[model samples]
Target: MLAGQRQSAILEMIAGSGSVRVATLVEEFGVSDMTVRRDLETLARRGLIAKVHGGATLVDGGSTEEPGFVTKSGRQAAEKEAIARHAATMVAPGSAIALSAGTTTWTLARHLVGVPGLTVVTNSIPVSDVFHQFGRPDQTVVVVGGVRTPSNALVGPVAVAALQTLNVDMLVLGVHGMSPRVGFTTPNLLEAETDLALVRAARRLVVVADHTKWGLIGISTIARLEDAGTLIVDSGLSREAREELSEHIDNLVVVEPSASGN
Candidate 1:
């Protein structure tokens, strides 16, 4: 294939699969690995895709406009880790916590592995797996039963019913987007409803999202910003954006990347 043709094909593959590894692209296009890397680098420079350690993902895939696990996971890695670390500090030992399903929430789950005597209730397969992978005997995980969404979140009547029965001390929510007018929103309608249930089931709501999520609006609104007890975001957030968000949210906890160590 010609250089242009190869690049076009690679773009199509990323659009279809949300992400593409360099090795896979090289094999498919019968090109050298360097050629594939160059294509990805060009795309990343154009803001068409995000280049990660082993792959490239469509830029739109990270937004709620596209719901792909691999695509979302590869974007905002450092920001998510910072948010998760800050979120983990809010969870006390032996506390009953409700965790929503999202890339940021998954990061929090990984950090929660060492917390003892904690009861985690979640509707995310990966969230449950994180606990199961490294949870202590005193730490119990409750998987809320439901139909899984495209973003790997459990939703529907089953999930809502399960959440209704349990009362959690805090809910760590992950949203697709957040805007002053639209508040917290998600692309999936059912998942939005399920998230509302999660909000109702917990005494306090702590939303964990990176600065990228600000100003973006999704299809469905889960809750108003003021409803949340805390909003955890990265240091990259601008002063103007922070001021705007503070007006809507009650207790905004901006977690800077450097503060993660503390």
Candidate 2:
């Protein structure tokens, strides 16, 4: 195929899947790895995609455009599920937990349905609904009222004020992106502020993110990596990235999605 055609095909693939690895493209297109990079670079130059560490993701519209829940929930299905389940194990009964809005944390909310005598606070509409529908009679669900973001998170002064009044056992935060330099981040500034409030109200920060979240920087920083008491990720993380993140995080739990228990 012509160079233009190959690059166009690559763009379509990224548009369809949200991301594509160079190695996978190389194998799929029967081209060299360098050739795949060139194709990715071409699309990136056109602002059609964003080049990441080992792949390319759809350009996120400069931190102003937050993806909806449907888009994010589709990105890493198995990984998010596994990460959510693993994070749920850390919760003890009768604990007060704050859940931030995001697909991964929403997944974690589902797993918490069985935990008895829990107090759940969240800015996520879907997350609060999870507890409302399935929570045990002893559980208390605190819905933080505020303006909702594209990611379906209720953020702003209202949400921040609600969080300020109570301290929780743990805050399970799901972020838009994560990096060594900036820590956990979000594209929305108000959402970031609300997340900070959640962090402040918790004894420990438990972050749940997929491997793809690495290297994607957002507009606002939520917390430094070391601030998180526990970071849960899926097995898809590369060894180099894992070792790097481990340096900053106290307990880095990498869950294997393929495992029977996961």
Candidate 3:
């Protein structure tokens, strides 16, 4: 396997079990110990994992540590862009789409610019701005009012209340992390609550997440894997991870980064 593919698989292994021993990885990949160590080193430098005496572990408190939108926007650019492009294709012309706040969904908003006569409801300031700048006059953008979370998502009684009254054809959700066990999760408790509200407002739920989000667990879960009808991920997602997720989520769509132009 390629180096990037191996690292992605290693990360998923750690995510599934919390920690992985070097000996186990060596046996699994049939690679030299030095190769595994180098892989661990690379993942550590990226702040994706922590090295231990014998192996590595997923970074501690990833579930609770919330970074700002700008910080996250830089973390998984290619993967997010690819996932967003595929998600945008799912939107029909004149459809009402609900976008929950996160960097990936914000990327999805950028791809929605050309769709005609669409109505977008969102709590993200940046997402609303995308529609404001590029959306056509016939398109409608509704920004929900509420308190902003660290990730720049608006959430509170107000956002939830607004969603309770509106129904959309689809909801595109971005999350901090996800797994078969936790379904879809976010570090912020209130954001999880508001996201669940957004999930209820749509008939079809499509989750957009990158491979890096695989093993990380957030404090609160928005829904079980079964709740979402489809999940959009990038080509970098590992085969093992994809197979595991396929058992829970119905539709798993993988897209290439280069496929996105607009």
Provide backbone clash counts, one per model.
0, 0, 0
Off by over 4 Å in 1: 1-64, 258-262
At residue 91, give the lDDT of candidate 1.
93
Alpha carbon lDDT at 112, candidate 3: 92
CA displacement after TM-score superposition, residue 35 of candidate 2 (Å):
2.7
On a 0 to 100 scale, what is the lDDT of residue 49 in model 1? 79
Displacement of residue 117 (Cα, Å) in model 2 is 1.4
What local lDDT score does residue 245 receive in model 3, on the 0 to 100 scale? 85
Q: On residues 1-262, what C-alpha lDDT tens digit does candidate 2 reach at each position?
A: 9999988888888887677777778888899989988888888888889887777888867655688888788877778889998898999999999999999999999999999999999999989889889888999999899998988899999999988998999999999889999999999999999999999999999999887788888899999999999999876676788899989988999987753434
Winner on lDDT (2 vs 3): 2
Best by lDDT: 2
| lDDT, candidate 1, at 186 | 89
**lDDT values, one for every candidate:** 0.84, 0.88, 0.86
Over the full model, what C-alpha lDDT does candidate 1 score relative to the true structure? 0.84
Compute the lDDT for candidate 3.
Answer: 0.86
Query: By how many angstroms RMSD does model 2 differ from the true structure?
Result: 2.4
